[model samples]
Target: MRTSSGAGELLVELNRDSGVPLHQQLESGIRTRIRAGLLRAETVMPSTRALAQNLGLSRGVVVEAYQQLVAEGYLVSRAGGKTQVADIAVVEPTIAAPAASGPPRIDFRYSRPDVSEFPRAAWLRSVRRVLNETPYRSLAYIDGRGTIELRTALSDYLNRVRGTAARPENMLICNGFAQGSRLLLQVLAAQGRTRLAVEDPSDNDLRDVAQAAGLEVVGVPMLETGIDVAALEQSGADVVLVTAAHQFPTGAVASAETRAALVAWATARDGLVIEDDYDAEYRYDREPIGAMQGLAPDRVAYAGTASKTLAPGLRLGWLILPSWLVEPMAQAKLMDDRGSPVFDQLAFADFVARGEFDRHLRRMRPRYRILRDTLVDRLAARIPELEPVGVSAGLHVMTWLPPDLGEDALREAALQRGLGVYGLAPYWVAGDGPAGLVFGYGSLRRKEVVEGIDLLADAIATIRG
Candidate 1:
């Protein structure tokens, strides 16, 4: 006899082919699990009727097994007529020794927001209001497309803020950008769309996602103005994913001509465009760029997340879909996780509608700008070899290194000195490209930024020697 589980907690297996009695087998299986600590002390045991129903045995067999276990002190009957594990003296597990570590390293990787800035008060207020006023039925299992309140609020907010003309019915709330992208890409792949084109040096996580969705990810070269439209057209890819508002790594906003051409390309080829408007909220110098989905709503899908604005642990994201893609995306979402937690969706909706979200962004924008400026200035002053690019907006800054300064060696040296620096080599998906480093300043203080740059400069000097 052995004990296992399937979906539920426990499964009891008994060999009827053996001459042993059924009740004895049942008793041995459960006893074996309890003694082995798989079923620990004080754990509630299943009722005899339920156990018998589950194991396809008579109530008498289950009752007999329970009685024997009770007699042996493996289980105890509580006042409420429930059976629970007795106090069995199990051997204590050994604890592992703690490993020593060095000083805390300053991390410059992108998207690490200063969680200290999260508006706990505002969030608590929204959540409290949701818990108090939202109907019990509304709190129950919701549609995969998300609640009407959140979608409506998002529709209004995106249109007013992101230049997107989204409708509530076409939106689906998801567990951040990763799951949203997976749901969309898997649906497209299932529809026989085989190729996904991304910028040559794009966020590699998107590549991993597309591949997992069974789509062939194609890499198109990225130009200063944005994605190379000509190369994208020639790549034989039916779908394209781009950070249109501000391209990652390069921070290149698509030129007006390129944006128009991309829409045309999608329209003419009947291909789809996936606009990753990930961190478009934190523009420092210029006004926020509008999303491409507005130009061709039917031909493009928009994905946005709270990961950048709020904490990533929230795992909150949304997708504004085209009318034609709504059904499939909703079905995908239902099959994926039914829907995201209603509490978050409800709270976020309240956050947006109450204007708390705007206030928080208003407060964070200047702080992030100051950090980005400090990073740029430090890199420019400390090491003239590093040329800061993509400083117009977002939480991070990218700096190009002179060809002679080997990126790999500098990063390794920096890591040795309690510094975390990211290089562009891993971002590139094709032919060799120029060397550069990406510094994420969102989570760092002005002092940390200054210190990190000095350390990077020292690493460069060491590599130069």
Candidate 2:
């Protein structure tokens, strides 16, 4: 029953006495041969009945194992042809390769926007209207501080929606939050404020951006309510960057008491608070949190972005500056990139002014609420060891892994199972503290989220075992 030495022939030996079940033994033997260069591409294996006869096992046992390998894309069969081993050359395992290539099979990573839900029809209509109605001068290199019409529209919108004291004149449109932070840090540093305070476990990219702009970043402890006020005072930082509406990664809303206290501290020290109101609109729990910039506009350099609301590829964001800093920030804008795309900004202005933007948000909020609940429910059902954090709002959840599963080991095992997960240790300043995973459900479908988390549970179980 064994093949002597044909170029396309393979030898799959099944051991019934290894204590491993016959089917599992066949599966492991085939996979190990594939990995060890024993089973080359285009090689054909003996038929299930032939192999079973050769190994003195029932035909059903060999067939069951062969079926599994085929289901996993490792083998192929034809109507009247031999079941050949699939081209193993093309099947480089996902975990064996670099992490940044394509989308992960089961991505538990964070900060993803659901592009499938963007208002395509409304947005296209706004773009067409902007080309028709906007004055020719508005399209030219006009105001370095962005278009006035857009700012005016935003003035009303922010006031109505977020309760921010936004004036058209005080707002400066820039590339996005990153640009706003870079310009603001440069301005503050020019005014002799080189050291700034940031949340301890804040976004690592934010920290990288701040440092890249030559500003020294100081760590301030972040609590469930907000940044620790006492810790802020002790850090001796003159400028503070905060995500007040909902803290990034953690999803903590700043408490009213802490907000007032922070304002008081800033006012006392003649300091400034840079508020990054990112992803505040998609609150699943209560009404949208009011902008912290509203409490004391002059003391708060409020930065807002459309990366989450609309799309990140748009690369559009705006900042409402304090009056005294408007011209300076505008000049900084001119120095930075000469301002964002004029047409896109005009189109966005028309989009927001025509009330299409708000409508899109309203439509998406319910869908996201369902997705969030599905993620929670699935993880709860499959992975009881995984505790879902940041359940209140935002596009993702940060689930803390239990202590038994070390973050590094679990991450590797997940990658092997074609799952993507971002560990929390990288975001911490200490770099060796509490570890967890950031699961982004925005771009994922409801069914995918459920299956993905279930797969994740299996991977974790394998690692634990």
Find the candidate with the highest TM-score and give its number: 1
Cα lDDT of model 2 by residue, 17-60, tens digit: 78889889888888787666566666667877777777777989
- Each prediction's Cα RMSD? 6.0, 16.6
What TM-score number comes out for model 2?
0.77
- Model 1 spans > 4 angstroms off: 1-104
TM-score of each model, paired residue for residue:
0.81, 0.77
* Alpha-carbon shift of residue 176 in model 2 (angstroms): 1.5
Give one digit per residue, the lDDT tens place, for model 1 in 242-344.
8888888899989888899899999898899999998899997887788998898999999999999989999988999989889998888989888998999
